[model samples]
Target: MKLVLAIAPDRFRDEELFVPQKAFADAGVETVIASTKTGTCEGMLGGAAEATTTFVEVAPEAYDGIVIAGGIGSQDFLWGNNDLIRLVQTFAKDGKVVAAICLSPVVLARAGVLKGKSATVFNSPASVSEIRRGGATLTDRDVVVDGKVVTANGPFASKAFAASVLSVLSPISP
Candidate 1:
């Protein structure tokens, strides 16, 4: 079975994490949630989930892909995290699927992987500026897939974003 590592801020978006996790589960893929620190993570919408490990503990070579869950906290916690950025870079270097939704795509932009890639993020002047600075072409689509990197606008596109990740990681679409 394929395995994926999901990295989220302590305050991740509830749907961004849960929706993709469920889709991966139903497709027979295993997912492990990680954060800057392990243990409980609260969602922006008040939902809670446990992070099985910390980002520093993850080995990029062991997983088929990486998914970044987004929320308001993502701006404060994830955007400039060096460890998470390294993980994203490792995944991209290894040609693994790299995905992010909402504001979290800025992490990919900050990691310098979104350069020249067409991707979408929750439209905000800040986010659009960041991605464009990193050389990405901003799009208005709900979900944009460029190579193995997938990006979505927000919670509304969570299901489709997860499906897109699955299709990239698996032979069959979920």
Candidate 2:
């Protein structure tokens, strides 16, 4: 399956983007990296990724899942982005997997897709408040999955978060 991975132009957590991306690649899933603009996106810790397209270029129907990578830039660039928000909402409405890691969950919350859902974000008062205000039941767990929506608390939870998303994309039989 193909997926869209959104990151801010700057300050997206390095592992939050790379780890899950590696998982998807290993599973043979195609991913398109998107940011506010096309080109390179820098991470908080000096890692960089080339954004294959701009957020506006994303077509929700073309992908099986959407993952928003987070960091301080998420608040600066993604929090109020209407297009990104609409993409999240559209993926949810279409029953596609929607996942976010670290502070990125706030984007999903703000998009109104987290309402009445159980989610977890980085343990920051502001992050917690954003999810709660959006009507989500906040969890302190490392990872939380509510239907097609999956959330991870912070950088440390990257692996578990990616696994949760992969499970949704390709479920394992008993």
Candidate 3:
């Protein structure tokens, strides 16, 4: 399966990007890194990754899932990006797996995809208020999955967040 992983140009939480990426890779999922521009993006903790594509280049239909990595930069760069918001909305409408960790859930909130859904994000006033205002029932859980939408609180929940995403994309039969 293929997935698009979106991050900011800089300061994306290192674990939020790397942990889920490793989980996806271990599950045989192909990930395409996307950002506002094509180049290397530095994580808050000094990790670096190269963005292979720009937001304008992402085609929702080309992948089975979308994951947005969050950090302080996400609040700065991704919150008001119309293209990224539209892309997240498209993924939700398509019934594709959509996951966001840390502060990135605000993008989903801004996309109108979180309406009436249950989700969680890092405990910040802006993040909480925006999510609730978007119509999601904000939860304090480490991870919450409402149908195809998966959300995690912060970096500490990255692994569980990824596992939830994998379960959505590739469910294990009883």
For each candidate, what is the lDDT? 0.87, 0.93, 0.92
Q: Return the clash pairs for model 2, or none.
A: none
lDDT tens per residue, model 3, 27-117: 9999999999999999999999999999899988788978999999999989998989988989888888889999999999999999999
Q: What is the TM-score of each candidate against the true structure?
A: 0.94, 0.96, 0.96
- How would you encode candidate 1's per-residue C-alpha lDDT over 62-141 as one tens digit per residue? 78888998988888888888999998999899888999999999999999999999999998889999989989999999
Error of 2 at 21 (Å): 0.4
Name the runs in model 1 displaced over 4 angstroms. Answer: 3-9, 171-174
Superposed by TM-score, candidate 2 places the C-alpha of residue 163 at a distance from the truth, in angstroms, of 0.5
Better of 1 and 3 by lDDT: 3
Candidate 2: tens digits of C-alpha lDDT, residues 1-174: 899999999999999999999999998999999999999899999999999898898988788989999899999999899999999999999889999999999999999999999999998888989999999999889999999999998899999999999998853122
Decoy 2 TM-score against native: 0.96
Model 2 ranges with Cα > 4 A deviation: 170-174
